[model samples]
Each structure stands twice: as structure tokens, then as C-alpha cells.
Target chain A: MKPAAFKYIAAESLAQALALKAEYGDEAKWLAGGQSLVPAMNLRVAQPAVLIDLNPIEGMAGLTVKEKPTSEPHALVIKAMTRYRTLERSAEIATHCPLLHETMPHVAHPQIRNRGTLGGNLAHADPASELPAVMMVLNAKFKAQSVRGERWIAARDFFYTLFTTALAADELLTEIAIPLQPDTPTARTRTCFMEIARRRGDYAMMGVAASVTLDANGVCTDAQLGYLNAGDTPILATQAAQSLVGQSISAAQIQAAAAIARDEVQPPGNVHATVAFQRHLATVLTKRTLTTILDFRF
Target chain B: MLCKDFSLRFEMTDVTQKRCFVLFVIKMSQTTCPPKLLQIQNLKSKIPMSDLHTITATVNGKSYTRTIESRMLLSDFIRHELGLTGTHVGCEYGVCGACTILYDNHPTRSCLTLAVQANGHRLETVEGLAVSPTQLHPLQQAFHEAHGLQCGYCTPGILMTMKAFLAENPHPSEAEVREALSGNLCRCTGYQHIVDAVLNVKDEG
Candidate 1:
């Protein structure tokens, strides 16, 4: 397959990229990493008239820990072009956002991660992608910039629908800011990620990312679980997660939550997994993830 | 060795009078005859300047600057433009991982990227994996010894991918090697000997 003839321009600065986006409007596609977009282009599924290459923008492919004055949670600000391989290798990701670190291996193959950007994946909003679910579980905020200005979109509200985002056509996702879980013992956070695919590295039939913030007495203060391939978008199990809050999350409660999660998810059947089988996987993975998080020595 | 002083000069004259482009690849110090210049015929004559991009990139330690169509994938550029055909293209959509190459020290799917994107980037293909004309890199040697490939079509991409994998992992367990190889699809060897081939290499780290 071959991509159609298009005008390609590499933007050297963020301002230049925004200007190009403003100038070209919806006919232009912002090229970051091109891991997913280029493949769609090659398949003739997406035929943009202009591709604004964002790889060359200065200071656009790194991460920094932005600390607050102890009252507010610190943030891990990852530039838009930061590669997934970098996030996987970074000690900061493991420390600051364990859910993302654990889910990195399941995102794609190492080769794809070597070039795929977190911003690109999040912006692409693939319902089956691991990053969007993990980002949702992490409660990360996405920074969208345009020639007009910049605005922050919460991770939970970012994904609008299938392969779509809340982002406007002229807006480019510049960075992703994940608030670091405060290490205060009064509310310690632990996360677990798991997915079941027909084959390793393929999109999962079902996947779950669970984050639990336990109080000093081991009571669940906050339980956030995000599921991929469960619906039209990355689905957050609000009811299932709410069942664990303000309780010890006993084995029975875990089972109940799993059942609720299974019932709540609306999975599309594929050749690999039937609708019933996908619901079963949701039950199994939900229970397994909850149990794993509870079992971890906090 | 013979192209130590190689230079390519594009004659930009007569674009209005004649729309064709004549590229003169001058093989320097190869006798002062007129036949020494290899002419690349009609390089995108009718294409507008906006649709064609002149990009310079280094591959296998050799630099090439060519005006290519914007839609040309990096895999096509390496094969058709530079003639480094060692990197195979099994699936153009980056699924098969047969078009893998090292872009700026990271192994990437060349088919998923445009040649215009390779501007100012360093690329290493399967052809660059040898120490000399008579010598193979240790991984290639291990693959040869272990019979890692059967059809050999997917070997180039696998070699390039594994080269980067081994570099990063240094010493990986059998399971780790298999996990790293999950990105690449190989039908012939069932991945046993491919894993064996990877395990055979000794990482200095």
C-alpha cells in the first residue's frame, strides 16, 4: 500500500507548527511519531492534504518533574513527542506513574514503542490502545495548543468516541501532565495493569488498569479502574470502582466488583473473542487486577 | 572504498526550457572521461516543488541527498533511492516488522515513516551489519551458525530489530528474547532457532 501524494513540511518550532495548523486547518494532519497515522495514510484510510511534521520541534521530546510546594501534587510533564521507549526506560515513570510503566510493554512491540509517542497515542484515542486506559486511570491532563492559545483537557474527558478526541482540528497536543501520586502514608497509591490478547503484542481482547489509593487503615479512599476494548471509548468502570471506595475491598467485594464491571462493559465481538467471552475476560481480569493490587505489600 | 570522493551534482539548468532533471553522480578520480558521470534520468520532472522534498540522510555511514516525492515511505527510499535493498518489506503497514531499521539509534518500522521524515537522521539497515566485505557482525554470524532463518525474506528486518534489542538488553533470558521478538513475525523457523541465534551472541555488558 502507498500513501497518496501530499505536501510534507517539518515545523522547527512549536509556534511554526501552530501557525501551520492554523493555516492548513482540517486538511492538515499533525505528524508526531507517525506510528499510527502513517499506517492509516498508507492504507488510504486517511488522506490529508498536508502533513505537518512535529518531530523537529525544539524541546518537544522529553519529560520533566514539575514539583509543587508540597500542598499540591507534583506533575510529570512529558513533551508531546516523548517516545514510549523512553517512558518505559525512565525511572521516573516507574516511580511517578507505575500504571503507565507496567502498561508500556503491552502498548505495542518494542520497535513500535521506539518511535511511538505518548501524545500521539493518546491523541489518536484508539479504543483498544493501552495508553489511553492507563492515562485515564492516572488522571493525567493533556495540553492542547493552537495558534489561538492552549487549553488543558482532562484524561477522562479527552477521548470523545472511536478514534476521536475532544481536540479540535487546529489544536495540537503539546504535552501530557500526569499528577504524581503523593507518597504521604495517609494515602498510599498502588497500581496494576493486565491485558489478555490472542497473541502477545496484539490488541487485547480485554484489558484493565486499576489504581487504588489506600487510607492509613487499609481502607480504599480512591479506586480507579479503566478498561480498554470494553466500549466505544476507553471505559472507566465508575460503578465497579465506587463499590470498592470506603471499604476494605474483601474477596467478596472484589467478586462483586468484577461482576459489575463485566455487566457494565459493552464489548464489540471480534473473530478472536466472542461478546460473551469478552465479558468473561472482563470479569476475570477485573478480579485478578483487584486481587493483585490488594495483595501487593504496600 | 572507490567512492571516497563521490559527489552528486544536480544540474538545475533549463527547468523552464526543459522540465526534466539530470542528476550527475560523479565518481571522482575514476579517469577524466565523460563516461565517469552516471546520469539519473528524469527525476520527478513534472512534479511541483511543494510536492517534492530534498532530504539528506546518512545510511550505513554514507550520506545521500535526494529530491523525493513526499509520499515515498522510508522503506522505498532505502531500496529505490539508495539501493540498500537488504531491508525487506513484508507488510507495508508496520505489522510484519520486515521493514525494520535503526533510525537515530532506535529500531523503527521504515514502512510507517516517510523518506522526507528521514532528513538529517542516521539510519542503519541490514546491509550495514557487517564489519567488512569478508566479515559479518557477531549477531549475523550467530544467525548463520544457528540457522535462524529459512526463507530469509524476513531475516534482514529481524537482524536489524534484534541488533537494537541486543544493544539495549545486553543480556536477555530466553523468555526476554522471545518477548522482544514479539514485534516481528516469522513463519519459517517457528522462532526457536531465531531465539537461539539471539542467545548465541555475547553482549559485552
Candidate 2:
């Protein structure tokens, strides 16, 4: 199928791109990797009058990891246009954010990852996408810019609903900043991401990302549990996370957290999975992710 | 001529002043301009039209320049424009990877990409996998020896995808081979022969 005829403009600079977006407003769409947008256009589900191509813009495709200084927290900054292939192979990401490195391969297949952009995936805001859950668990922040100015939104607040984000019509997601795990011998942080997809590259019926920080006495100090395909937005198990924060990571604690998460999530029934099945998967994945992070058997 | 001078003045004013001047011109032109010119201006103001784009890309080791509609699919450009039919189009959606090709040395779905987006880029289709007219690439030869094809439709795409995969990972395990081929789906031969063919080629080295 062929797409509807549309005007294309290769954006030369960030300012020009922002101006074009401001001029065209809702009639224009920003072209990132185009893995999702192009296909949607071909299917005639999405037709925009103007496409501002962001591929040619400079300073929008790299990764930078800043280690913690005297009083500052460690941070991992990823430019919006950075490809998934780059993130999958980036040593900087592996060193700074190991959880993302482990979760990268689970994102579609290698071919799709080669062309898919980090910003595109986030902005697409698919309920089943892996990056949103990962970002939610890691407490990442997104920098959105327009001709007016720039502002940062937390990962929890950035994702508003299904296929929608806090981004305005004229705003572009410029960067993703994830705070890295602190280097503390007394309290060690462990993270894990897991999902169950029917096929290798297919979207997961359910996925979970869990991060836990344990103090010296083997008691949990901090915990974050995020689920994909759990609801309209990436669902965060705040009540479940609080339940595990003061207790040691044990089978009973994991089960309690998993049960709370399974009860809190309300996934819609799709052709591939029913609501009950998705809820069951949420429980299973939560347990698996927490166990993997805790390195405890069953 | 009077309208032309008025538009020149409209263009030279500041933004706030220009907005008022443009509204004034439109109101004045509605009464003075001919019906046909007024109709044309009305159509232009209400609707946006697509324009042809000139794109230059190196496909199969040869550079070509073509003017295409902005919405033309790259898979169609490879087949209809450049006359390379090896890259097959299956589902037209990103799900089916039969239209896969090497875009700048990375296996990308040609069906999902716009032809204009491939401008100033390098692409390798199924036609480029052969070393010569009579000679076949090692993977192609292995497919032949191992009976990797029954319908021969998805072979070109699988070959291109695997070529990029093997270049990155010269020695991949059987599990890794299956993982790499997860994107490309082959209905014929049950994929056992295909896996065997790749294993045969890996064993050759």
C-alpha cells in the first residue's frame, strides 16, 4: 500500500525544526527513525500534511555518561535521536546503566533496533513498549524543547496515556536523562527486566522492570516495580514497592509485592491475551524480575 | 501591477504589521481580482499540495539520481524505478520482513522506508549478494546445497539479513542464528533446512 502524498522537509537545525513545527503545528509530524510512523502512514492510519525530518539535525545522536562527583549524582544522558543499535552496543550504557543494556536485546529484533530511535519509541508511547517501563523504574527524566523554551518532565509524569505523552504539539523530546546507581559498598542496587512475548520479536503480553537497593543488613532500602502492557500508561507498583522497602527480600515479601502488583494492574483484553491472563503474567513477571534481582531461588 | 507593489510592501513589514497588511490585501483582492485568480488564491490558501523530490542514492554499488513523489516507498523504488526485483514485498507492513535490505550496511525494512529518506545513503539489495553473474555468494551456495528454499520468494531478503548478521557475528551459535533470523519469516522448508544451510556455511569456515 502506498502512503498519501505529503511534503517532506529535512530539518537542517534544531531551531529550524522547531520553527517548522510551530508554523505547521498539528498539520506537521516529526520524522525520527520512521520505523513506526512510516508504517502507520502506509496503512493510512496517520496522515500529516508536512513531515519535518530530524535525521539531518546535528547534536542529536549520542550517549554521554557522567560519573558522580563530590555532591552530584551519576547520570546517563542519551540524545533523542540515538538509535537502538547504538544503545545496544554502547559501552557507556553498559557501564552506567547495566539494566538498560540487559533489556536492550529484548526490544524487537536486531533489524528493527537498527533503525528505531530512542526518542521515537518513547514518543510513540506504545503501552507494550519496553523502554517506558525501564525509564519508569529507573526514574528517568525527559527534556522537551520548543521555540518558547525547554522543560524537563519526570518519566512518571512524561507518559500520560496510551499513545500520548506530556509533549505538546510544538515540543520535541530532546534528551533522556537517567540517574545512575550510586557506587556504595554498604548498599548494593540490583535491577532486572523480563517479559514474555509469544514470538521473539513480537510485543510482550506482559513485561516487568524491577530495581531494588539493599542495605548492609540485607534489608530493602528502596524498590521500584514497573510493568508494561499493564494499563494505559506504564504502571508503577507504588504500593507494592513500599511494601518491600522496609523488609528483607524473601519469598514471602516477593509474593506479597507480586500479588499487590497483579491486583493493581488492569490490562485490557486483546486477541492474543485475556485480562485474566495478563494479570497472571504481571504476577509471574513481577516475581521473576524481583527474584532475578535478589538472586534468590524460588 | 498595483497589487504586486502592495505585496512587496506587505513582505517588507514587521511580523505584526505584516499580519494586518496580509489581511488587508486579502480583503481588497476579493473585490478587485478576477474570479479565476481569486479562486486560485482561495484554493492555494486552503489546501497544501505535495511536491516531487530529487534524491540520489547508491544502490547495489551504483549511484543513481531520480525524482520521485515524496511518499514513494523505497521497496517500490528498488523494484519499479531501479529495476531490482530481488527485494520482494510481502505484507507491506513492518511485521513481514521480506522487503528487508541493507540500508547503510544495516538491514532495514525497505517497505517501511520512504524513497526520499534514502537520499545520500547506500543500499544493498538482494541483487548485490552475488559475486558475479555466474557465481553465487557463499550463503547462496550453501542454501542451494542444503535445499534452503522451496518457493524461493523470501530467500533474497533472508540472504541480505543474514549477510549483515554474519558480518557482525562471524561465528554465531545455532541459538544465535535462530535469534538473528527471528525478524525474517520463511514459510517453506520449515526453517530447519535454512538453519542447516547457515550452519553448513559456518562450518565451511
Task: Judging by DockQ against the true structure, name the best candidate.
Answer: 2
Q: What is the C-alpha lDDT profile of model 1 across A1-298, one tens digit per residue?
A: 8987677889989999899988867567889989888877786656667789988888889998898988899999999899999999999888877888889999888889998999999888878889898889989999999988999999998886666688887899999999998668799898899999766877788999999989999999999889998886899999999999999879999999999999889886665578899899999999999999899747
Query: For the second chain of model 1, what is the TM-score against the true structure's chain B?
Result: 0.75
Residue B83 of model 2 has an lDDT of 95
Which CAPRI quality tier does the interface of model 1 achieve? Answer: incorrect
Query: Where does model 2 exceed 4 Å of error?
Result: A296-298, B1-49
True contacts kept of 1: 0.47
> Which pairs of residues collide in model 1?
none
Which 10 successive residues of model 1 chain A have the least lDDT summed? A40-49
Task: For model 1, state the Cα shift of residue B8 in Å.
Answer: 46
